[model samples]
Target chain A: MTENRDSIAEIDLLAYADGRLAGDPVRRAAVERHLARDREAARLVADIEAQNAQIRALYDRVLDAPIPERHRDALWGNAERGGGAWMRLAASVALFALAAAGGAAVGYHARDGIDVPSSLIERAATITPAEAGDATFALASTGRERVAGETVNLSFAMPDLSAFGYRLVARGHPDPGAPNLVRFLYRGVEGKEVSLFMRPRMDPGEERVSTRTVGDVAVSYWSAGPVAVAMRTDDPQMDGIAVAKVLKHAVDFARVSVPGPLDEAAPLDGTGAQMAVEAEAGTMLTDIHAGPSQLQ
Target chain B: MNDDVKWMVERQIPHLRRYALALTRNLDQADDLVQDTLERALKKRHLWRRTGSLRSWLFRILYRTYVDNRRRWRPERMAADPALIDAFASQPPDQEHRVEYTNIAHALDQLPDEQREIVLLTAVEGMAYDEIADVLSIPIGTVRSRLSRGREALRRFRSHTEGAAPLRRVK
Candidate 1:
């Protein structure tokens, strides 16, 4: 335990104990001879080994324990759904669409008589799925989203949702007033669509999170630091509150820039089309630098 | 991407699960962490291509996810009480190792996360100093320092305190 030259350093003794002393035989023998004289060093090595044995004894059983059903499904369920390669590719594409479209839509929704940045995830009154049919979450045909004759870049911050049994499907803009708004949609294992609506915070405020269920659609909304996001899904097992908590730190603010104005909205496939209504949220993000009342 | 690499990943699940269980001490949460790591690793499988050690890469992701969850929800750890020291390698040991296991698990939970992880990787997984460095993304000297600190902290439970049974004398 002493630091002196002849006195073996603790780490050297530990290395000797861990059997990493093979690097130098002379040093290893010297350390062993040192241990023969030093009772403390020998005892210390034994205790360290004992601790290791005890830990292995405690948790190594998990090596033989049954893998969980959900994880198993995620790993090998590719055949039933699709190949893992195809699903992963689809996941990346879903991420890109959410980044662009979901941003423009949420920004516009928060600016309209809505107290954004804080309560953006709490209040849900006017927007409904009944009106969601007409909005075309259209591809601008140029590979970039265009808003009002100017091409806009939308970036969405989304965490990988595969572990939670979800994948990205499509995006939509569900507002009668704002055609430029965008919303990204996700499909659960059961083919139910989970809509994610996001808008960048114009005036950064304290983070807020809240969950509510309307018409069997569980919605979780949270605004943290730079952006506000809302996600709604119909899966009975989908715990909106839990998902929102994870997402509060998980989602990144989508970046929206206007090279042009809004064009189209898309419809998502679901179970019997029990559409979950979320605000058209992407357009007003450009207004973050446009100052207060800019989007109005 | 290929079958061989896919199989290699699948084989590490049980080992990953064990390390995770030791970290969280909860079966469900540990498995959830494992699930998340596997999904993310597979999704980003290309990144793992050039790494010299797959286990190190996988474990790095595991602990990273564990700490992320810890930031959101840190399950309260039992404070290390120097008063209630117990022997880990019992005298006249039984087959189950029940008493020794509980005492050590409790002792381990008391150490700080950084130290606990270093100790567990070194002790439980039998990882060498270099592998510990890779797993933690820390310098080897730092790993040694943390290990020394952790061992001294944990040794109190085994080396000190007056308890029911006497520790078997080690030569």
Candidate 2:
């Protein structure tokens, strides 16, 4: 305990007071013993620590304040004006989309231990077989949506995966208790199925795309503005990144049609749709492919 | 900038903003200072040596920006808005914390800018002596001396004003 007792210096007092010496117990104990007999040094150390705590208490909360969106825009500057802002935006959205997918996996309550609403799984299991055809019907869960105490009409078109060789064969709310929850069952060749789930998030979150395997089902999820979408497909060979890219673009495009307060609360500026389209058309398109590997 | 670079810069904004606020004391001014810092950092992104940390690089940019711009503005030292402070507090602070906040805010404002910067980087930001030296472009010896003087001055100010109401601007 008295190992470094003689090595304590004026500088060590400050270090000990600021907790820089915390990892070095011998030095810390030496400083403590120095403080035991040296009342003035002890008072100085106490005051220094007190000052640190007070300063931190006064200002640390600024960290919790969401970075002002304009700064986010500024950091990723405007791409069309010759900066890669949209790509940065897309990259960020892709990052969060992946995060939300993980959260959805947990919320979904998947058989591999990623749990979602079991009722949705049950409904997907019990869904009646559709008559044969390549039909793409859009099912929208539209209503006067209330967010943060104000009613706003929120509508975003469900992704059409027809290009991916899948056609919407059925549409309805899988969870009746959650009327806002709508599911579109898409049937591809060989009876392959991809169910797209749509719901309005309670608050607008950053846009992102992430995927998780729910039992045999692969769930690709993304959220933009107030709407969250999860594309669940059981086909192992399915190009999920391509489907997610399509879903993300469709959802971002639909935000252009969502005219009202919802856009105001969105992470992007009022020109979010334009930005989203630019992001889709730009480097982010390529960037999204690189996302799943980096994120997973 | 690349997405990777942009994200790296983006992550450091809050810390930059915190240091800027500590330096300037006014929110709008702090934000403006940080905005300038980010602009400069982006413009000179090539200057950042990958050998060093992004946090230290950003802090270096921020400190230099503060030094370069200090002469252009009139002394408009205002207390952080009480309501802003109230919002920042996790729970409502009692009368004692309010007094403590006022005392330290006043004491901090009174320090020479050099000492104050070192004190804050050391105490508030929890930067090491060498990191402080790197950020300020000073020697480790200078960092220690300035920090010692700064904390001692704060302690002296507190002792002299014990049991007294610290003066606050009425904004």
Candidate 3:
């Protein structure tokens, strides 16, 4: 039983039985010798050979047997349906259109009831108000600097509300201290998005807030009454304090709603249609931001 | 519709079905497994960007699906029907003696699922050790070891059965 034990590795014997070791002459010869000397090993080889023969018999007939019509039909059906390629392409186009529309709508709504420059809407979209309630006193400011012959619009949004409410969606459970605080992020011009969020905190009778800068982005936060405010700005050229001041003003405007001489009511042709379009645009933008493009 | 792909699918189905039948030992279950494997391959065709052989990918899906279903069912103690075994054994012996082959099949049914898979893939499917490794996502050494163990077990089972019934071999 042990005559050629050292000469034949079990793995080599298996490989030899499988016919994979046919090209390896040394191992093959060793296994053959071991098989000759050992009855158990020879039986093992015979069993394997028999099993192989039986399997061939079982399946060799299938080569001549007609392929079931169902399988062929399904494959053809898939091919006729464009094999999911066209569907994916259509989804991608729909997603891109949605993202563009969503971005524009969010920019416009965020600009409403504020006296910010129209050119600064793109920058305002990236602004994150520091302190919870600071969003109530918001403003937009833009600084353009020529970078390699291209003018880059650096904009910021300042919200004055120290106490504000927002939702948080994260891959993991949110921290207890950051309850009711949510982060907002937006992809910007350079293929990079700014990250910022707000959490409500209490400070004395009068609600006041503070701001801090993390990496290239600035985070400002405050707690006022029941509201909390936090704004993030990644623009290097714009001052976080200046943006905070504008946000405070916007918050005050949201609270008091003081009517100005230029504040005239405009007639709406179809407010429902406008809202639906805006909603659809938002959905599309969300899809695009979450699609394969972002993953790539 | 690539004619080559169509032709390949048409040709491979019978082989795939036969392999499925051997694995499941039931026609309906085998067809269901084959269908599921094909559906998955079609959905994830992007993963098959001609990196390796298509047959390997298909077999991998089939093997994984079978394993998953087995795990879900957990029919560990279910015994093969003695009547079915006898029926298979009583079939006319080929020139090489069919009784031995039926004993092998019965022994294979008794093997542990992992060992049985190794036997079927290597012996039944005629896959190389490396191909078995790829299909099972195991090291080649593991495949070899499992095959050896499976073969040894089957041989022992056959020898024991033959010793018990000497007259069974006469007819």
Candidate 4:
């Protein structure tokens, strides 16, 4: 009996029992043939039927109960708000305090032409990398000044990279919904102010690295080195090469360990590879790195 | 979003509660489980994607919540009262045999939680094997095997209990 039982595919019997198997006439017939002769199998089938009957009798009443109204109301309530306003205000205040503390720490570095502290560089590194898509990275000077009718305050210790022909600028907020935007404001020669906004170029099978004009600002934009760096400035004469030179120098100064060329770097994981493919597909470089913690 | 979903949920709540009652054997707990499942469904409505039947999704939530709650809190078992059994026996056979139903319930209670779930989802709820698979996140093959084993266990239990007791007279 056991030897003959080996011929019966248990899954087919189960599926036949559950009524899920379809279009496989051969296997279905095989199971039916075995069931016809086997008394124990017949008994097993009866038992299953009885159990099913019992279960149906037990739970058929649940279908008639009323759905509570509160459940639907809660769903809409939770979904619409991005985050509470109080939380956002608290975060802004906390950020200001952190900036003040950071500025005091980096005050000596700016006064004396010494290397910026490692902590300051690391703090700046926390800002999304420019190659990572539309996000801004800024290293604000400890000095405060009014800009565009708003009193802009700086807190981070600025690196004196004037020798490299790149000046650190007053940090400004990036435009919401910009695919790739980075703002770094700095006082250039003769106290002239400049802001760098770099946005990555759109490309296929590769993340875009490009430059374009935004209003009066000449932006140097590129998607290379796993970040999108955008240097935006009001200077009409400033071109891509000059902006790129300044960005490269500033990023080099800020980056603790520069990554090697793309080919040498480890391949991206499944999610990262998917984002890279999307980037190559010319989908506007959406912020892919924002995970659950950044939901607010 | 459709009237069909609203209609289905409205029509199916009683059945869901009855099944949940059978599963939990506690009226309050059963209702709580049903409520929790509905709340979860409402929150995750965006993920519905209109791919599968809504009942399967609802059942999946109910099953998972029941399993999780069982793990978190030990259920309080109600002892079978001899007087209640006597009263059930005094009732006419033509009436739904409360004693027999209680016997079946007791037998179901003895089965492992996983086996009991398979039994309830398949036998009681009239869910397709594919629907059960989707609800439980198990393969169809596993569902079949589990269902077979669960039925066999139930049969043995019912038979053993039946053989031990000749029809006792009501006091």
Best by TM-score: 2
- List model 4 lDDT by residue over B1-171, tens digit each: 332233334445655666676677666777777778777776676666444545666777777888788843234454133333332222333233455656666788788877778777766655667678898999987877777777668778877877755322221
Q: Show the lowest summed lDDT stretch of 10 residues, model 1 chain A.
A: A271-280
lDDT of 1 by residue, A63-181 (tens): 66666767756565553434454345343323111111222222112323333433334223224555443323443333433223444444434543443445555445555344334
* True-vs-predicted CA distance for residue A256, candidate 4, Å: 83
- Go through the candidates in order and give the clash count of each: 42, 17, 57, 46
**Residue-wise C-alpha lDDT for candidate 4, range A181-251, written one tens digit per residue:** 33444443323334444332222111222333322222333332223444333333333343343333332
Task: Give per-residue lDDT, candidate 3, residue A197.
Answer: 43
Number of residue pairs clashing in candidate 3, backbone atoms closer than 3 angstroms, sequence gap of 3 or more or interchain: 57
DockQ of each: 0.14, 0.17, 0.12, 0.12
Compute the DockQ of candidate 2.
0.17
lDDT of 2 by residue, B1-171 (tens): 565456557767888888887887766777888888888988997886454556788899888988899874223555444665565643466776776677777788788988999998976677778878999999998998888889889888877766554323111
For model 3, state the Cα shift of residue A252 in Å. Answer: 90
Error of 1 at B78 (Å): 7.7
Per-residue lDDT of candidate 1, residues B1-171 (tens digit): 443345445656787887776777655677888998888777877776432456677888888888878854254452122221122122323533445555676778778888999888876666668878987888998988888888888778655532735443221
Q: Kindly list the per-residue Cα lDDT of model 3 for residues A140-229, writing each as its tens digit.
A: 111112222322111122231111111111111022232233333322222222233433222211122333333333344433222244
lDDT for model 2, on a 0 to 1 scale? 0.58
Q: TM-scores of all models?
A: 0.48, 0.51, 0.46, 0.43
True contacts kept of 3: 0.27
True contacts kept of 2: 0.39
Q: Which stretches of candidate 2 lie over 4 Å from their true place?
A: A1-7, A79-296, B72-75, B80-84, B87-91, B163-171
